[model samples]
Target: MAMDFSNAALPAHYGLHFTPTFHSKIPPNIDPTSTTLPNPFIVVVTGAGKGLGYHISLAYASAGCSGLAISSRTSSDLDALASEISKIAEKRGTKIEVLKVVADVQSDSDVSNLEKEVRQKWGRVDVMIANAGVISKYVEAPSSSGSNLPRGIVQDADWARVLDINLNGVWRVSKAFVPLLSESKDGPQALISSCSMAAHSTISELTPIAYNVSKVAGMRLMECVANDHGEEGVQAFALHPGAVVTPQTKNHAGGQWSDILADDEGLAGAFCVWLTKEKREWLSGRYVSCNWNVKELEAKKDEIVKGNLLKYRMVV
Candidate 1:
């Protein structure tokens, strides 16, 4: 059935109501069967050279999946990560492949080359993670920054750079890989989105306007992709990885370790373990936090899906 959520109300904490049809009704902590884990799947992660991307790629590699790590400006870091994964895979006697590629997601030609390379190496890709992004600095121009910028204030090239990498880059990668994902006979492919809690909360102290806006747009992008391809087995999810200690967060904010541990560390770990579990079909197109609150969020799935579809039309 077509999912619809035209009249649902958002939770009080989010300040907006978004209810939808086609709820999963799955328990938050329910575990998937062993056969459902995406092992031996070929996965690709952008910005996988460092930070959260590095750790996430490692997690997948440790789980016995072949991973391709890409970066725009950090070939050395990407190489190191690939090498480390190779070592771990060899020690475990599990056949996991790690390929490191240097391509700027903002450049159409670069991303095109990346697609070509992956296709040549692997016939099909089962998973993709669009995780590359940036933040704003305080040393550039006002007009070049964004529409909300105030007069006489220098916003810096970093502002536009962030949007280019966070938004346009994602578009480039997803567009290039959709065909490959659709070719999979097992079913549609999966996309893991690195979204943020800032999108739902107004904690100005915790988030800057530019970062929040980009992340919100990112989550909606995943929803739209899911709506378009879910019928064919291509599913996407927007995930808030919580406060993992990454260079991106540390560059703009502080308290990396403390922020992550403030919540349940085991819960987050369990969620990661669940990510690769089989029966992931039950979790497709959902926005997941630390704990697998799929059922609670299902009530709003329809509205979220519709809003994302509308936003996609505007962009196109």
Candidate 2:
């Protein structure tokens, strides 16, 4: 069996091996509005209509990113997000060119259209966050009667739909954006995918098999990207964006799991900005959690590298 990266299978002292220190909000050091990124930096974020995606775009805009490309299937959501970003830019007295595109990750042509728009507008991409994802419909939740409902197994179509969006969708974005990342000259060319702690879960009652398997596979896929593109100065990472309450999770388990979602929604966005603020190649191809304390993580860099922790492997 694979020795997964879950808490039970790893050392406790390592922050990532256990539940990280809960950060309910963006810290001062990583606050985008306070800490500005370099000029001419352009970023592309998929699924930017709401939830984590919305916050991430806001964080980038607040940080004063020069160019921002946000894609969502819903045009109205994109319009609203663009307006909010404009307000942020005005408040900060920074000019951020916001590109709102209606594109679905599930469609090859739509993703291609997103890429074309970015290439035409800026001709390069400094950071790409493949954040588009979905949860399975067949979940274990509390029925109105207050009794634990039976966990329904995900159907074949439901399983395929999850993988198509969560795993294959990431692949589509990577294929369409890596060339632009290579063209970037003044920014950190980083590719970050939103993986999850659920990637390590085996309990079907807690997470659907499709979501679980897709995340696991997506983590490995990012590893492959790092290995394949590191020489090109393109750093890649798979990230667990912390346990925040999103539209997807607000009613998860019929609010039975609300307590776990108390984490700050903006934590992941700040973390992403920090991750790509500079090139720390040591962390490429690894799995990182947004909730991990940055100071502690920095202190443990040598040990982490020497031991080659924060990766997927099989233990004897």
Compare the candidates by TM-score and give the number of the best one: 2
What are the clash counts of all predictions, listed in order? 12, 0
What is the TM-score of each predicted model, taking all chains together? 0.72, 0.90
- Give lDDT per model, in order: 0.60, 0.82
Off by over 4 Å in 1: 1-39, 67-72, 138-157, 203-205, 251-273, 291-316
lDDT of 1 by residue, 1-316 (tens): 1112121322333322222222122234533212133554777888777666776676566556654545545889887887888886786677776666888888999888878887888878777777787655533332322222222213333456767888888888889887888786473387777776546643332444566667788878877787797777777777766555456644332223243323332233234445534435555666666433545455555655566321323323
* Candidate 2 all-Cα RMSD: 3.8
What does candidate 2's lDDT look like per residue over 174-286, in tens digits? 99998888778567899999999766766554556788889999989989998898888888899999888887776555433655576788999999998898888888899
Report the error of model 1 at residue 206, Å: 2.4
Leading candidate by lDDT: 2
